[model samples]
Target: MPRALVIEDDHKIAELIKIHLKDLHYEIDHTLDGLEGYEMAKKTNYCLIILDLMLPSMDGMEVCRKIRANDIASPIIMVTAKSEEIDRVLGLETGADDYIVKPFGVREFQARVKAVLRRSLGKFENQSSTNNQIIEADGLSIDLDKRSVQKEGIRIELTPKEFDLLSLLAASPGKSFNRQSLLNLVWGYDFEGYEHTVNSHINRVRAKIENDMNKPSYILTSWGYGYRFNENI
Candidate 1:
């Protein structure tokens, strides 16, 4: 059973989330204020965190920044009423693993939580494995243990999801994986109907690794098929 922390100010919303998470066999701890929530998060060990952007005593962004600054790598999913693109981008930039808008369906929220947890666990397992440490294709290098990628001897920064998606494709160069397959492999079993997630991350990865994202060289699209890494470079 995975442990989770819910930092939400709304009692009703928190209770609803707790009910859903309980059904999923997760142990949950919650706080109503941002300051208390941040303290609880730091003091306890949790597999994931469901945080709200608007909170009393402190702001969600401040808590997120503090958590990242403290080097807490536990996956965090922001739950916010604010649906503005800028707010979403800022949440991601602050090291949030994912975000959910208010009035979200219970099913979708549960799925997102499971997906984030699965990705986090997959990374942990990959890091612990010693057999498949690093993979190189052409000038691109993927360090599974370090969770880093490099091209032409220069480090390329990638979000966690971006790294996982790219690493999966690079590991099996030339093997095409459709949107749903990629979502299942990278986002986990619980992910559903969020293929756009894969598309956006792919674009970001290409922008970093390829000379031109518009004309990607290493990661190639298979038209109506899907995406595959070019093994021959």
Candidate 2:
């Protein structure tokens, strides 16, 4: 059975999540402290991580950042009581795969979990289909199977999301993708107003891969449409 971790301070909430996850056939580890949860996550490979935003020892945002920094690419579902747009946006920018606000119904929470898991599965499937495929343009090289990127013979480390975004664009050079399309293709969910998520990720990708952010050669703004890879390269 796949494993799941729940890092929630509220005993009742944690138990509720645990019960539902058990029903879903996931072997579960429950922790109320963020530091301990982080340690557990580092040691164990979990299929899903449900983390509360406000945690003792470490907040969820910090935990998410640290996990991504360490290259732990497990899908994470952030649980927050705050409903503000900034909080949700920050959570996503921090590397969370999804977030669910408190006071959410069980159905909504379950749907989010299913959606994240489905997306993870879809990533694996897509990778298999493109196995051994490599796209080269200018100095940039993307190995789809290895999920690695290189520029001018030097390795460039990218977050999982960053790699996905870059690979998607590179796979179809000159094909413009609107923010909504990118969001649906990359995030696996339609987050209506979270289009800024796409912008922030694009900026980060450019910062890493482009020689000049001011005049990027790889990814170009489509002018009133969205963004696309430079076919000229």
Q: Evaluate all candidate structures by whole-model CA lDDT and list the values in order.
A: 0.79, 0.85
Which ten-residue region of model 2 has the weakest summed lDDT?
119-128
Can you write out model 1's per-residue Cα lDDT over 82-172, one digit (the tens) per residue? 5555666566657678888888888999888877866754663433454777888778888886777889899876656677888888777
TM-score of decoy 1 = 0.60
Report backbone clashes per prediction. 0, 0
Best by TM-score: 2
What is the lDDT for 162 in model 2?
A: 78
- Over 4 Å off, model 2: 123-160, 204-217, 223-225
* Residue-pair clashes, model 2: 0
Highest lDDT among the candidates is held by which one?
2
Q: What stretches of model 1 exceed 4 Å from their correct place? A: 123-233
Candidate 2, pairs of clashing residues: none
- Clash pairs detected, candidate 1: none
**Tens digit per residue, CA lDDT, model 2, 42-142:** 99988899998889999988998888767677889998876566878888877888888887777888888888876654453454576448889999998
